[model samples]
Target: MTSLTIPSPGGRLASTVVAMAVRQRAVIGDEVTYVVLDRQWQVVEPVEAYLEYLRQEQYSLNTVRLYAQGLASWWSMLEDGGLDWSRVKVDDLARFKRRLRDRGIDSTVITLRPEQTAASSTVDVGLSSVLGFYRYHAIVTGVPAARQFYEHVMGGTMEARSRYASFLGHLGGGQDRRVIGRRREPKGPPPFLTPQQMKVIKDDAGRLERGTGWCGDLRLRLFWTLLEETGLRLAEALLLRHRDWQPGTGTTAFVEVQPLEDGRRRLRAKNQQHRRVYISDELDDLYGEYLFLLVELGVDVQDDLPVFVNLYRGEFGRPLRPETIYDWIEGFKRRHPLLPSRWTPHWFRHTHATALLLAGVPEHVVQRRLGHRDIHTLMTTYAHVTEDAAMRAAADWKALVARWGATA
Candidate 1:
């Protein structure tokens, strides 16, 4: 690791000004893992330990990489402040939060408010990672300074539930602790594609070839269809295998989203949790058509092979990548002006949930279909849908009351 030092503001001290970086290395037999390097270019032991613990606890590789990046930012902050990692205080963390918020401002420009460089939610993610690092060290190594970052509060108290339990504690009873200076984020609905927009995008993805029944790019078409219909995450859909597709009796079918470890890439399903997402019979027929197209192209299909693979581009038969999907969306948006300005693959998930709620589906049923471990997440995320539903019912209440009066 190469290290560089720059003199501090008043030339009073030389501080490491270089930011830390994350690297991937093969540990055992094609299995890959991530490690963080400090500004001085040495492995950060605490971060390495925490990442390993996450891996052992079955956290996805993408999640591990994300946490590593956050911790890397923390290490850079510590170096910039010339502060020791082990001796950081609550005030230091607050400063760190400010630094993150002001990350992209131009030094030459002078303006109040700093133009809001980073979103509050993004800063919160970084802070959460840093706090989790300290929390791990405090519990495992009994580091006194690390323990100072949190305040233990009794369970069943409002503050405890709202603060401590939300962050680091188990639900429903016991003493818990929350990190100081963790910002409260606003609750809002996630963005989703409208039905007409989804239809246009899917139709544009793959068109039927003239004089032939095959679509131009069946693989890409199938991908958008799967996400739109089933609400699968980008990674979850990418990690799907041929065997995971279960064709039920007489036109019914479902796809099982499993936590498969792909040795080639660090791709895994989010949360490493298993759940089945049912698909429409039309989608089932689409899958079969895609298979037929695969055979025509001389690409062999197998049960263990990834469902979405690169048939038209790099490394035929290799798993489709999340980067490729993002690139596709970028080009797609350029071609189509009707899509939402801030549309994303995640919008399919939001759209799916919103549609279900609006169609009068029970919250719990939607929760199960979406593979949420509990209904709380479902309720919190789609609360806007429920609230809108209530308002509509209130608007129709006069007619409802009149009907009841006449019946009586």
Candidate 2:
């Protein structure tokens, strides 16, 4: 549908079929299968092209899957409503937004999460994805109508017209931008484990008896420690390899974070950059112990093997999945009365970033440590820290003012 055709000398039926075994997987883990297209390139055909475009741009698989789903869902909605793709208007886009905002969304359309609220935050997410799909087609094929709908309706720009114009298609990428800050209330800072709670949890994890058959509590602790110390994303830490870690001067080490680039098995880093994190000897030793446990369990200690693997779950040597840790953490919170029910692996990242900033680490340094591309991103998350610091400074100023008045 997006115009990838290899014309054959033997006519249409004699075309060679490209084996999919060697086809690149979508940056999204699960890529979509190609659908047969009609002579016209409208409707769903562009969806395939748009997905491939995402993969080419190195968009993550999760991102690609969302675009694919959003587009396909919108396409189905269009077909059912007897609407023409080329003829879609700004008002139609509003209708789609309302439909997504309504309760009782068809399970087939979207699988809602507990955290997903109706009408605003979650609905905006869907609208963004769907709008992205249209943007993809507009940018790719330079479709004027699609671009107009995206800019006018979705971007909150001017509306589409009734009569056709003999003008050029979507001319500029900057013509439209996503409308933001319209939420009823902005989200609060990410939750984090308190220092006291972290210690208690670490003690509980440290006291894990390998004999109880969970041999991986120490491994979990190591994972958590890496998050706390390094501020590495959970996925980055999970996909770590033995070779990725480097030993440094007395009681110190560094963990290399690389874009594992090629395989679906070892996905690329979220930020897709190569960086290293300093590690303490204590954590390095914990890592060694975890490795030794893996060896004791007859798991291979190859340099390229994933650092974290299933220890008790029947799938033994397979890389430990996030869901496993999520469930484990949930159960852990249940077992230990001190741990917060809302605490998660990601919270460690927030906790680490906050700790570093409040400890007087420079913003640029914290940004690099957290693998954030922009210092503004770091500033945005920790803005509350800045405000608190300012408030404390104001108190000092007040004290100085009082002293000056007394002297006067």
Off by over 4 Å in 1: 1-29, 104-116, 152-179, 249-251, 389-408
Best candidate (score: TM-score): 1
Encode model 1's per-residue lDDT on 1-408: one tens digit a residue. Answer: 335566679976675644545443546777777788865567988788887777777776666776777787778767766888888777777677776788734344788665757877677677777866766666666677676554321112233333222223342136444444455677667876666687778887886777876555778889888887787877788888899998757745888889677645667776567877767667888888888888887778889888888877788877787778888889888898667767888898887777767666678777877778899999988888877855444233333223211111
Residue lDDT tens for model 2, 50-127: 666666776666665555554554565565577887678866666666555553244345554533436575555556
TM-score of each: 0.80, 0.73
TM-score for predicted model 1 compared with the true structure: 0.80
Off by over 4 Å in 2: 1-43, 103-119, 154-184, 208-216, 249-251, 261-268, 389-408
Which whole-number lDDT from 0 to 100 does residue 261 have in model 1? 71
The deviation in Å at residue 190 for candidate 2 is 2.4
